[model samples]
Target: MKFPEVVSVEQADQYEQVIDVRSPAEFALDHYPGAINCPVLDNEERIVVGTLYKQVSVFEAKKVGAALVARNIAKHLDEQFSKNPKEWTPLIYCWRGGNRSGAMTHILRQVGWRASQLDGGYKAFRRQVINELEILPGRFQWRVLSGETGSAKSRVLEGLAAAGAQVLDLEALACHKGSVLGILPDQPQPAQKMFETRIWDVLRKLDPARPVFVEAESKKVGQLRVPEHLFEQMTQHSTVFRIQASVAARVDFLIEDYHYFLADTDTLKQQLRHLVTLHGHEVIHHWCQQVDAAQWPELVGDLLVRHYDPAYLKSSNNLFTGFATAHPLPADKLDGPGIARLVDQLLNLQG
Candidate 1:
């Protein structure tokens, strides 16, 4: 049978299955969205082949690698692809679209199923992501939600989305809250490429005619940086929905929302340690003591007044354009009903 032809990653959706033939570690780092990993050579096997290629000879390496590859492929054929219908058309890719994916495609075609390799592999998909991000930001009209930390901007975005508003919750996408202590309890952030892919996926689906409601974020969310074009567009937006809530209300909201911290005091203290340099050792020591003593509301209230609020004021005023004239949306509380009212107010005012 003839070798399968290479297809572009852009045609990914048309295929019945998308197979990633890279090593598990490579796939874990990043892969095309929705591609399933069916590594022909696992991490250790790949290392052995590579070491053999360096120490012995390319011929020797291939001799060893081919057996390992064949065995793994047989296992996959039995376990993963045994039940597939004859008409199954799968798109396969690996790093640089080279030997790994080619082997899988060849084997699958020999099994009488139509299979195609991804042209340029994961590299090509990455390039497409970069190209899309370079232009996608300017395509949407944005309405930035500008507010201090604990003012429930993320919640507001959620409520807006529920109300049929076009919302882009970057913090949620990043699996972070966008602060020194923003790391989620159990959710690890996606790889940077995957993060870009997620942003690209959302941006492509949004209607340019309608405004996309987004939070005003710094250049970085936790460890991931916002795409430059998107961050620039967010800052340039003149239509801002400034959320106003009393510090006491924001404290109450935060206490309820971040109850995870109460369960994991050590992790909470560890996160609080990051603020030590900024707030001084004495202040952080006091904060830790509060956490130990279970002074939840008082601790949150103090952090807002002393640490978060001032930082927010400076950053919001300096970084975001038209902050002085932002449209005010009063939030008496940060509960569901309050957020619903805020969402309604936003839509009514903006509409």
Candidate 2:
């Protein structure tokens, strides 16, 4: 029996196995979460066919693609379908749910398993992700936290979440801290579709009636773009908590938090270099010397004052002037009890 394409988001979500029929390279660059790569035609074959379609004719391209598709499907039937349990119902997709997924479904059914195709393939799912993100913030309440760099915004989000407040760490969702230095040591960011899907998953599970605390951020984090609709809601629907601290205290906090950067002076130097265009060569050079000498606190202060401070001042002046209230935590001195008190006050303020 020939299966139809175009399942709803709920139906797609319910499928046991989500298979990506695109090539491994295509899958690696970006794909749906939990999707397995089972190419109906490998990367080279796809490229060749595409080139043929452009250079020659659609008829010739289809002729070549058909032969390659049959060959690849046979391989998958022998190697993969034979191993899976009888109950496995795989939902498959290609770039646009064209020939690739159709070919795979044909083979899977021939082997006696129910295989289906996603409507409009991965592209359609991506559209749904965008739509969901667009509508989410309107359906939920937002409590925003704003502060200078190294003010531990992400940490505060985690703490509040632990304390039973709904929270969305947009940076964590993006696999980036939303800064130049945010790239994790070895891990790469997820694809845009996967990022949106992850965000939707989190949003879907949240209590919309409760306020979710989030940090103030721009529309883009690393390579991923936050939906403009959600961002617009973030700007209007949220109340801001300003966490203020003195330069000295903030520098100390930064040093303690980012000690790993101190281990390798070169890493700090490279990051500092990016700031040199704004700060000038001599200023960054002197700071690099301070970093080399293990004057971490001093280095942190200089970098912050030179770079983060001005930006923060401008942003703070413009945004959240109507914040519900400002709860000033001690900058120069912070401990478990003090932080607990601050958090308690913030939560109480919510009530």
Candidate 3:
């Protein structure tokens, strides 16, 4: 068997196909971006091998684990990678760049495929993401879009992105709308590491010379925390734009954005239960009754009036230095045309 060639995390992008040789559960948590899983031991098999290593002996574990790894790799070679041309080069990785990836890399090389293993594996990619995230945020001038819930700030940010402006849509990345009720129907928020990786991935490709447009957020979006440097630069050094709309307009927009919750009142009421401590039991019960009656407009308006608006006003004033002198942008609606017009107004502000 040819010896495995180990490549550093920095050289990861040089390959067209990056294969992860870790267990599926590990890959599901976080992996190098664009890396495909071709796990050699799978979930249950890994547990069996680890238990054997502790209970029996390293020799016994290796004997069984190697057999399993060889069987799986042979299956992948026959099924997933049989037709690769001689010029096709691939990178493989495992947790800590250990024996799992090393064995596979050796096998591939021996088969006349020039396969390389990632040095230090997924951990190295994570470290690179962390280090890059720390520096990348300060490199760009952030323009923070500040507004209460339902003010169409997110839509406006989307419009900017669609128009080819550099934007970081944190809610879209997190898969939660930044509230207790923010969870999407079927889309769960990613692991916190994956969230940071996503941010790092987007930030690395953006032009630092241009301002990055982002929606104002608290330290956490859903359960995902924003990187400290990125949050600091945005609140401390960025300019703020108040995306303004009338309370009526805001209520309408929110009803539309959160329409998914409208269809599933049981889940909506369950999420509303989290507000009992802040809003009190009576208020929470009344909101639940509104849900029972399908009073979406009223409930959304009440939420904005009693919950989101005051919280936003206090937070925005306290957090953003330029919020007092923030540019007021009156958005007619949060619809496509309105968002497009808002983007035009925002770009004009840039000039």
lDDT (CA) per prediction: 0.89, 0.76, 0.90
TM-score of each: 0.95, 0.85, 0.97
Backbone clashes for every candidate come to 0, 1, 0
Model 1 regions more than 4 Å off: 1-4
Candidate 1 TM-score versus the reference: 0.95
The lDDT leader among the candidates is 3
Q: What C-alpha RMSD separates each model from the true structure? A: 2.1, 3.2, 2.0
lDDT of candidate 2 over 1-351, digit per residue (tens): 333444644577677789998988888766777788889879999999999999999999999999998988788778877788877788889988878897887777777777788878888877877778878878887777777888777777777888998988888888887766666555688877677778887887898878888887866788788767777777666676777767776776677766767776787688778877777989978988997888877778877887887876676556545343545544443345545665676788889
Mark the 10 consecutive residues where model 1 has the least summed lDDT. 1-10
Top TM-score prediction, candidate number:
3
Report the C-alpha lDDT of model 3 over 30-107, residue by residue, as the tens digit: 877788999999999999999999999999999999999999999999998999986668999999999999999999
Query: What would the per-residue lDDT of candidate 1 be over residues 1-351, giving only the tens digit for each residue?
Result: 332578777777788889999999999877777789999999999999999999999999999999998999999999999999998888999889998888989999888888999999989988998998999889888899988889889998998898899989999889999998788988999888778888988898899989999998888898999999998889875477799999988998999889898999999999999887798999999999999999998999999999999998899888888687898888898888888888889889877
Candidate numbers, best TM-score first, in rank order: 3, 1, 2
Q: What stretches of model 2 exceed 4 Å from their correct place?
A: 1-6, 74-81, 190-194, 246-249, 321-348
Q: After superposition, how far is residue 200 of candidate 3 from its true place, in Å?
A: 0.8
